[model samples]
Target: METIQRTHVTDAPPLPSPWRDAHVAVVVPTYNEAGNIAELTRRIYDLEMPGIRLIVVDDDSPDGTGALADDLAGQVNESHPGRMVVLHREAKEGIGRAYVAGMKEALARGADFVVQMDGDLSHRPEYIPRMLGTIMAAQAGLVIGSRYVPGGSLSAQWGRHRRLLSRFAGIYVNAILKLPIRDVTGGFKMWRREVLEHIGLNTVRSDGYSFQVEMNHLCEHMGQSIVEIPIHFEERRADSSKISLAVQVESMLTPFALRFGRRRRG
Candidate 1:
């Protein structure tokens, strides 16, 4: 494992309370996760962590995932009250764009910390408390639920070829970008609001799998403290994998584009 140098955000805005009093925003980007949306939100709300809010950014799925998300939000907020929100985008843009919109909304609503996770059950809600704990304990700028980290494991259902490809992708990206983080392409992550501010979300252009790489690259380029915790990544509870050949090609080509960018120092 490469050692990532940690740095602090100077003149940073006030951060939320570690676990209590902090306004935590969870951004769930959905495409066609209709089958899993209800359960996903229910589990998140069941955590019953005070100051927890869920923002479901739906990209207008033809399968009515957006409508289902709205229904779930309404049902959950009835008891929890203002704890869940749904942002319905006009059309499918990309996961990266949805996240940018959701994060911006969270910030606008005065969220102290923002988390990004898949709407599918693959990114378990059970590990959220642990992720928050890791960020606070390490005082990290970002905390990633990493599959490539020590103690992390992938789903047994994955075939050898899929596993090999994932490992190879990680190794290839690491060599090109030289990021100290183990799972650079992993989607499950939490960010301190200041890190997003420092990295300039508007500058991120990746629209697919490479989005994770772009965000990780920005964090490394800015010398932000990133902590990766072991997460057992399981297969999606519903829906097939969305990784297309175009996405794979984009992932393969992104590192070279980022290799020459100047690191932002403040």
Candidate 2:
């Protein structure tokens, strides 16, 4: 394990630069990612994204992901001067909760833009540049590194059934809540701090991975611009996916609730 520095950031930094100062922190919420965390963090830290930073949120992964995250942070602090933070939790909560925790940690540490993705590398790090590019060019509140967009494509490992389910979820959300982007469910999203601050993150309802859909819905409800960029989606090679049959059922049922529920849009 790498030796992660434990110093806390006490003040928020100024946010005025291209794509929110590229001071962006890619938040990887992990469960049992010990096998993948080190290499993944090393690759991203070496990618030369200028102000790009990373924060690994581990829900006290039993397989030692939390310890690995601390190690990664320490190595980053020693070798690189940019920034890396790790937030560890005591139990394995859902991804949605993990993300909320990460967002708060990032904001507390002065992150201007917070990017979210899977730690097993299913969402390619190479697309980080393109996503950030779109955000800067359009000043969009949310930029999705999408696989359903014009130039995006998915890997062949996913079966037709999986594809159909994903597409159906997109259509359902788009038609019901009427979000503006094609890949409303894509997790490889970048968000400007202003968007989170404005959306009232504390009030988000979705607790599963479907939280991605709810976030897009919130963005649309608030009339924030969303941009989609196509990219190849890679399959994970290490740990098994945390997605479950329960999540699939939730994804199918969430749009309907958001559409007709007594609450306002999002």
Q: How does model 1 score by TM-score? A: 0.89
Structure candidate 2, residue pairs in collision: 2-71, 3-74, 4-74
Candidate 2 lDDT over 131-168, as tens digits, reads: 77778779899999889878899889988998998898
Model 2 — TM-score against the truth? 0.87
Model 1 regions more than 4 Å off:
1-18, 261-266
> Which model scores highest in TM-score?
1
What Cα-based lDDT does every candidate model obtain?
Answer: 0.82, 0.79
lDDT of 1 by residue, 153-223 (tens): 99998899988988888999999988998888899999999998878777787778788999998887788
Cα distance off (Å), candidate 1, residue 129? 1.0
lDDT of 1: 0.82
